[model samples]
Target: MKLPNPARRSISPFGQRGLKSFASIPGPTSLPIVGTLHKYMPIIGEYKFDRLHHNGLKKYKKYGPVIREEIVPGVNLVWLFDPNDIEVMFRCEGKYPQRRSHLALEKFRLDRPNVYNTGGLLPTNGPEWFKIRKIFQKGLSGPLAVKRFLKGTDEIILEWLERVEIIRGKQNLDYLPELSRLFLELTGHATLDLLLKSFSRDELNRHSTSSKLIKSALDTNSCILKLDNGPQLWKKFDTPLYRKLKKSQKYMENVAIDLLSLKMSLFSERSNNTQTLLEQYLSCPDLDFKDIIGMVCDFLLAGIDTATYTTGFLIYHLGKSPSIQMSLYEEAKRLLPNKDSPVTEEVLSEAFYSKAVLKELFRLRPISVGIGRVLNEDAVFSDYEVPKDTVVVSQNQVSCRLDKYVPCPNEFKPERWLKSHPLYQKNHPYLLLPFGHGPRSCIAKHLAEQNILVLLLKLIRNYKIEWNGPVLDSKSLLINMPDGPILATFHAR
Candidate 1:
């Protein structure tokens, strides 16, 4: 939607000219050998790329809306703080938008071509990406797919609520770990149809195979992020982290093979009418056990981390503001009046305030520093021409927090998302994209929203939420995760 007196300025495209022909964009001056790398040595020296967003925010404050910086020699990045530039980059992204591939992940999977034989969404584009994505769209997108998941996810949430009840007496709960385990259980049950029992403390205490497997998978994921955000030393030659990553990948693959075997047996015993994602993929002629495992691994990792952290941050925000908490409770009560009422699609649709809270949370505390796309062709953004194959990054956290799109940019105001609010009319809808738009928007968007909403419904219904902790901040590696555990309390409502 367009705003009156739009902040977007007209762009005059340069026809096939060199990027250097244009005026130099404002950014930190680069050193001859290292480019601008020396400036970031403090964070890089510690291998703490998670603090990248903080650094980016600092630069945005210093350099204004549009800045171009060379990350290292031979690698230049144009960081777009304006939402209109983000829109421009997205429109020019072509049919097969090339998301910058995760280096560590690509290497880990390609190293085991036997296991990860085919390229998945992250590494593939064009017809191959479309083909792989279509398979997921049929099973993971649309209302039917979302409907199939809702009941299962809600069941998991209710079970988790019981876990919360059991631990209610604790003075403070470490929200992220517990939330992580809950989403892990939900994703395992929903995708693999295997009850990995991630939320089961007893099973974990017993040191079961599933627990070990889950730990290995998580460790492997952590390694991928660390390596991706750290350095390219592992790319040229093997390192300790690379070795650990390989071992973790092997262990996870072995666990998946075992789980798939059991799943195949269970599929035989059960009726075809009820099938999981793995079973659906198994029906494909070209795909094998390994391919199915690879897909499952993607879903398992992607689903859990995103939902866990998003929900954790939303709750953290709610807990921080008692007024917001009370208003949310009122909305929850108004929507699902009865304590025993089941959370259904119809009920969730009417929970507008709850959805507003989530939207506002994303706008104020976006998880990623920016979303990146490799340009398919030469393009001009804010009248500055950049060449083809250049990596253009939308500084999302910066854009979302700009006063041009948001009123009192730093404040937490869920009302701004409400249609009745005057500020809502002034905003550009693209400014607050938690999920990047276009053909490559998150496939699990609906599933994650449904799950988060259901959990929020139950949470508000059950507990009077409280948060009296140090300021909750976020860190960004491959994705955004809370910098630390949020201290929270749950007084039974």
Candidate 2:
């Protein structure tokens, strides 16, 4: 039973490939069109984020540090890693834009641009990005975020803790939706003050069409994510999925316009007690309505998604290892924080084991597999011609997982990050960048840290988490999730 060569045909997302070098690129050799696709099938559903850190390591080892393959017909992507390449990637802020490449990132620009646009920080590039980045540095980065965000985390997290307890006594539940709801609510209040403190205890919640437009922008683009590298059916034809994806874009565009219109009724009246985020933007007379709202939307998407998934991973790993879990709980209890003594600037700074737990979780499961950067110019890397618009994809996931950095990357070891370990600070400062690095890093880095810290402290301090079903690993979907409903048991401490 010999298989005939199918490389003579054209390859699209829905097409076939005729290139010989395709099989040699270190991907799964057996189902070529499918390639490594089946291995990822375990990831199709809700618990996706749980396994991303594991899959990243597996694929990188099976392939090479750098993998080149078609995500779709006529589209090729290179996923590369090597610390030296960091400078090649981030040194310039011009020719290389974040949203370029197969992201079909062009599709995201229906609205006017700001920080998250393909040029400023999240995904954007150019002279405009450099200037805008400066404002972020002065306004959002470093000391200010740490100073302002650390205090509010306790109140926000305590509210989420009660919501999470619904699954604590139950068995075989889909806790991710719970986590998402919690994260979304937490992000809204803590970051934007856009929603109620606790989930409205209501189902079929109302969302403005403009809000839908904001979500649609994410969903439509998200629909194209892993599809670029799979089979070739939808690419060559007007598949229903493609139609739906296109329709979503149109719906979102109309939604964006509706939300962008300046209305006296739409604006929230300023009060002295309004959250800092809303206050800052409302006072920025230079920021137009459409762009500011879009930026707020972008901020929510990035901030909420990362924190939810990362906090989910932290809990998952903690549940996986009992000894470390015990250690964390004991340390948190030793500190004994109360509402009267909430997680404050000093409390967060003083909590040594909390830092270890977070750093270890981040080391093992960086929410982003690698930090993405746009090459500002056409550059030579190891004498390779990386064109002006090329996107640099580093293997931060595998980098931190490697034996050199974390010893046993697969095995969870909070002990590796202990203060006594001499290699703790000096060995590689950016190895565990769950919040990202450099100037373009997350504006809510401190905010996320505080949020996760509060939630984890509460959970560990109250109960010990154990599994009631097959242990799940983190998977990916834009960010990350567990492979399925995480079934766990909680014993009160």
Candidate 3:
């Protein structure tokens, strides 16, 4: 599995002599107008959009590491399965990495000129994205910024745990919905300085703001997967799926505006001693109100699913492995000896085993099928000279699980991440990128990890988690998520 040294590869400004042409990259035979899109169609199709991670593995085995597919007629996608090639892709990703995801979402935002300045961070590219990113980075980029929310986030987790106890008296529960609410509440606190009260017993009504926001976010994401993966008919005209996306986005937009207005009105009354993420943005001279709204909308939309799915999978793995769960429980107990102890920066730093558990979970089941970048410059990958503007996807989920990159890839061995362990992996750093790499990486990375770690510590200490259902798998809906009901049993200690 040793790859040829990238340094030895022939280098050129654009195209290189004796190197494989981009057209020569092995892939499934694409048809006339349909391209390889038909291959993802119903029964005859060999692939399912929802099961893209599985499809990536299958493609890698069939076509070898580097794969080419014209997903739509003219859109050529190069899939990189080799960690070395993935590293090359990122290295060439340039200052403003153009990730061509959520085209339909971008259109949706641009269509509404009055409401949006740009398509927000997820879809926007170049200087506009960098401008907003720099502003938000000041508020959310590092551990110090995320640490301010430890007490508040812990309070939210405690509330959700109480709700879980009431809802799951003695039965296995589909906990994803609860997890979604918990993350949404956390996102609200971090991004908008609002307590969404998503877990409030009195706000059980389905039409509540929190409930509507959650539903819209989920619905919009579903529509995004369908529209982005399928035909470009939505681009030509207002298709049915496009309309659904608009509706969901419109709802979210209204909610963001209302919340922003409320927060701004209360801004003057707040103490100058502490600043929430929202207040920091409002106080920044460079950002306009519209810019703040765009950021809040993006954060709310993106935050919930990633954290929810990652936590769900982590819990499942812990439940499935009793030894690992016990080990993590022991670590959690040591970190927070009292049941009601708050998760501080010191507690987080000391929870080394808990950190390893998260790292291992990410390797096994990444929240996204792959990390994608629309190549900013022509780059050589796997000896093929791929041109600039081609969408090169880093199939990390498939590669991370491969025996070539990781030892005992199928086993849940957190020790692989521990430096002292015999099974410790010195795998390529690019092999596992759950938060992605470089500047375009997830802005909320620190905050999300803190939230997950705090919740994990609390859950492991409080309950002996168990799962007796069928083995869990993931489905891609913009982000990879648990494919079935998370029917995990929580046995109170």
lDDT, candidate 2, equals 0.56
Q: List model 2 lDDT by residue over 1-493, tens digit each.
A: 1221223211122112332233244543334455445544664632132344555566677766555544333444556554444444555444324544223223344333542244224445555656545544444565455466555556666666665665466657655555666666665554344443334444324363423433554465355555433454654565665565556555644533443343223455544564465446545664445445445455555665577667767767877889988888777776665423466666566678888888778876677666666555654333234555545566777787677655556787767677697535443544556665666666667767777876777778877888665666555555554555656676776
Candidates in order have lDDT scores of 0.73, 0.56, 0.86
- TM-score for all models, in order of appearance: 0.91, 0.74, 0.97
**C-alpha positional error of residue 335 in candidate 1 after TM-score superposition, expressed in Å:** 2.9
Better of 2 and 3 by lDDT: 3
Best by TM-score: 3
- Minimum summed lDDT over a 10-residue window in model 2 is located at 7-16
lDDT of 1 by residue, 1-493 (tens): 4642323333335664443343477877867876676666764442235676666677788877677777555667778877777777887788888865556666878777888865566656677677677776567675556767777777788888888888767765687767877877877777787777766766655266545555655566566655753456898888898888677667767777788888888788886586667788887776777677777767765776777778878878888888988888998888777764678878877889888888888887775666788888776776577777887888888777667666688888888888887667556656777877787877777777778888888799878988767787777745677877867888887
Q: Taking the candidates one at a time, how many backbone clashes does each contain?
A: 0, 36, 0
Candidate number that wins on lDDT, 1 or 3? 3
CA shift of 199, model 2, Å: 2.3
lDDT of candidate 3? 0.86
On the 0 to 100 scale, the lDDT of residue 174 in model 2 is 54
Error of 1 at 338 (Å): 3.5
